[model samples]
Target: MTADTSMTTVKVTTEARDRLAVLAAEKGQSIGAFISGVAERLPTAAELDERDERTRQALKKFGIALAISERAEGEALWAALDAGDDEALLKDPDA
Candidate 1:
């Protein structure tokens, strides 16, 4: 990997700076390094939306053409999962 030795300053509120510094110290990283790692790992709303669409597309490709038809259905699915009844989600591909 090519190493680029460059530095940039960012301004934040004192509270934010202190909080970030504490978090960074806990992880044994400098503030800049910690922020860079977070940026690399965290997904923005648009990124999440794209991921959701791609997941739906993959599911559709497997013949699960119907997305959860309603919010209630989604909640029910979650309830099933919480109760360890996830078999409700499995279906014969031909059906």
Candidate 2:
């Protein structure tokens, strides 16, 4: 990967700053070096893509369950909706 030489400022709480300072000193690294090391460990594109795929699958399953629940009748439908039971909505007889 190409190196990112751009510099940017990040603001954090005083408590967090102090904690990071101590951690950096303990490791015998400059604050910038310590922060850079932490940034380097962040999720890559493939890891983010996998996370997005899992989230999409979960949402698709919930949507299907909600649609099935939409077939419920009168009070039962209202009850399920009020109770926020997506699975109960899927048990509708006419669905």
Give the best candidate by TM-score.
Answer: 1
Model 2 residue 83 distance off true place after TM-score fit, in angstroms: 30
Residues 1-95, model 2: lDDT tens digits:
23878877889999999999999999999878799988787878788667666765787877833343333354586788789887775784565
> What Cα-based lDDT does every candidate model obtain?
0.79, 0.73
Which sections of candidate 1 miss by over 4 Å?
Answer: 1-5, 65-95
Per-residue lDDT for 1-95 in model 1, tens only?
12666877899999999999999999999999998889779998788768767877898899877454543476577888799986968843335
| Highest-lDDT candidate | 1
**Cα error, candidate 1, residue 7 (Å):** 2.7
Q: After superposition, how far is residue 46 of candidate 2 from its true place, in Å?
A: 5.1
| Global lDDT of model 2 | 0.73
